[model samples]
Target: MTRLSAAFALALALALAACGGQPASEQGHADEHAAAGDHAEEAGGHSEEERHADGGGEHTDEQPSTTIPADVAERAGIEVQPVGPGTIADEHEVQGLLTPIEGRVAQVTARFPGPIHALRANVGDTVRAGQPLATIESNLSLSNYTVSSPIDGVVTARNASLGGLADEGAPLFEIADLSRLWVDLHIFGADAQHIRAGVPVTVTRMSDGKTVETVLERVLPGMATASQSTVARATIDNADGLWRPGSAVKARITVEQQPVELMVPLSALQTMNGEEVVFVRVGEAYQAQPVEVGQRDGQRVEILSGLNEGDQVVVEESYLIKADIEKEGASHEH
Candidate 1:
């Protein structure tokens, strides 16, 4: 009985040892699989990091810059001008109309009331002083008398026709000498206060933008009833007869001429990222230089900061550069 009991205990002990050894072997294989998986994960992480480094190498500069070839800039009509000193004329813009000088106009009238015998002039006809314009049959003398132009001018109106009755003191022909003209600029509200005689005025014809520089002749005593504006007069030469009377024009009255240390054309200014910028060129790249500006006039502006003398600034077609830079930035964001 004792031997049987001892044999049972020994068999049980052997069975327990065998079960524990099998579990240890299975655990060793599982640990090896886990280590291999960790190594593979580490290698994959290194590959991902390498790919990121390669992508970074291809990255562009985040600064506000545009690359434009010289040929491209020329083709785009982009004009670059060096920053320098210039005169910024403090000009006040006002609307105006061209008129014939009052002293140069003539009203040809019949000396005595009668029937027109012969009409020799028509509208747009050029005539000289004392040139016969028409012949009138005087009622008092019952004789034909010749009427003559008193001044050299172009006929602007012909009130008397052939065989028409003419009245004494009534204008029969209106003539004007167009060699010189008066630009009647109307200055409203505050602009009239700065206006005075002898100030330089630049008159631009609204039709074709033809400009003529002249001096302010005078300011009328009375305000214009229709516009409630002061009338500033300037004389412009019209020997070519291109500036017609009664044509609307724009006048830039330069009240002050100030020489600035650095100035650029108004076209050189552009807006980038909600700030005023001027594109400065260096080689093939244009960088947006934020600038603080001073006084500005009709054609030019004073540069207070962010620019140096002789810096080549893009004065024309700068918007094109701005567009290209923004497009590149957008593509990078995506």
Candidate 2:
């Protein structure tokens, strides 16, 4: 009885111990799965936080940058210059006509009215003073009439012909001194005061395209009765016979004087806000400077202020530069 009872009791105890260890192994496996899930969630949240803090680094590096367009700069065509001093002359241009300086117009007349016998001088013929122009045979008995030139010049007009009646005070020929000529200038009433004797003058003839330089010789005391304007005379040397009488011309008279001022070419100046301005080059850029102007000749202009001597200036194509600067300023405003 003792041996069989011991064997049965040992087997029952072993079976009960095996059944108790099964629940503990399943609980340890469930705890391991929950811990793995928590660790995975924490790691995913930390990765997302880092990405947000970095602000999408690769995309931020790819943002676009601003730059000046080459086409705009090309169209602008900007130019720059500096300030300087130069000579400037103020002159006035007036219209005029040419005339003989020293000459005599004579009319041929016969003591006894008769017909022309022969002709010596014709129109446009050069003759010396006192040279015979024409001869006439009178109807009166034993009479001969001879017409002569009164000055050394070209014969501008002639009316004597063969067998033509010779009458008193009849114009046979007109002679003019071709060596020297005069220009009759008409000045307005207000400008009359500016013109005087001995003022320098330059005359340009329209027909032959010649320019003659001279000085004002005389000014008529009274104004012209027809035009109510004063008349000024300028004498010119014409030894080359380039000038002719009765030719229309243009005369420039220097009037005002402005001594020793900073000057620049007329092309160097530009108008800005109703004031004259110039672009001064400065270190790969340009600065606009306002300037005051005084007297001006044909090509140069007097600078009254806002400039110094020995400053480099742009003479050619300055207007184009001004336009570019204005366009750039407008673009900045927009």
Candidate 3:
């Protein structure tokens, strides 16, 4: 009986050895895994090649165009604007204050140290060129010297009173024309780079948001001590007496500008995979189209290529378009 059992066990062991170590189901699973690995390697290589061809290389700045459904874009507040003839004024919005033009302001001062003999032009008094602001009895010369207004203006400040002592070049009164003024705008960093003489600027009063057109006269070569920003000076005609000096205001200084046949708002521009992109409406899908951008102002950007007149472009909240395109790509990879 023991020999018969031993023979049966030996026969079973020999049969298992003939079929290999694993069951048929297990063997099948192993074979399937190996096939899958080979297929994955093949697919990964193909995807890499496609990506490189489609401008997906690490140093490549061009991005492959993608698309999003029209309905989805609309729900995401992706506003579209038609590309057509428009003026793109490369402008910057900056804070400014109305200032009196230098030649229009007169700081009436005595040439020598003296005592004020008489005060003629008080604050709020209008005076003309050579009009006496005060008569000073000089301490050195001991003669009464007439300190007169150097320009036709109204006296805005009076520091010397009747019988007051005055030092040489001590301002007795300040006279300002107030007819012509300047918008002293402080622009920092890149905004100050292009600002120079002859650029058109618009000065808006901060009190009531009143706007007046003007041209930038010149940019101060030095920066302000307190603000650390360069000052851009624009001369504004104040003949109407509406614009006042020393008042806070806002200015739109056009730095660079060009008229273009087609343009889009700055908000419409998006960077995708190191390339500038804008979503354009096509049929029922919004195509994330790579674009060649040109002279861009503060508000709009010139579309040099990849778009045409009357083509609708996504202007607002375009990140949703980018996200949807990326999601679709990930799904296809799986």
**Top model by TM-score, which number?**
1
lDDT of 2 by residue, 1-334 (tens): 3433533443333233334432464446547756865686687733433544665432221111111122322233433345565556567788888887653454444556678888998888889877888887777764776777766778877877788887756677777667777788989867888677887888988877688788888998988788787889988888888787888999888765555557787888878778887655433334456678887888778887766665555465455445555654465477
For residue 274, model 1's alpha carbon misses the true position, in angstroms, by 2.0
lDDT of each: 0.82, 0.66, 0.76
Give per-residue CA lDDT, model 3, range 48-93, as digits (tens): 3455567642212234334333444444455788888888886789
**Higher-ranked by lDDT: 1 or 3:** 1
The TM-score between candidate 1 and the true structure equals 0.79
User: In candidate 3, residue 47 scores what lDDT?
Assistant: 42
Model 1 score (lDDT): 0.82
Top candidate (lDDT): 1
Once fitted onto the true fold, the runs of candidate 2 whose alpha carbons sit more than 4 angstroms away are 1-90, 108-112, 141-146, 207-209, 272-274, 279-289, 295-299, 323-334
Evaluate residue 234 in candidate 2 and report its C-alpha lDDT on the 0 to 100 scale. Answer: 86
Task: Report model 3's TM-score to 2 decimal places.
Answer: 0.49
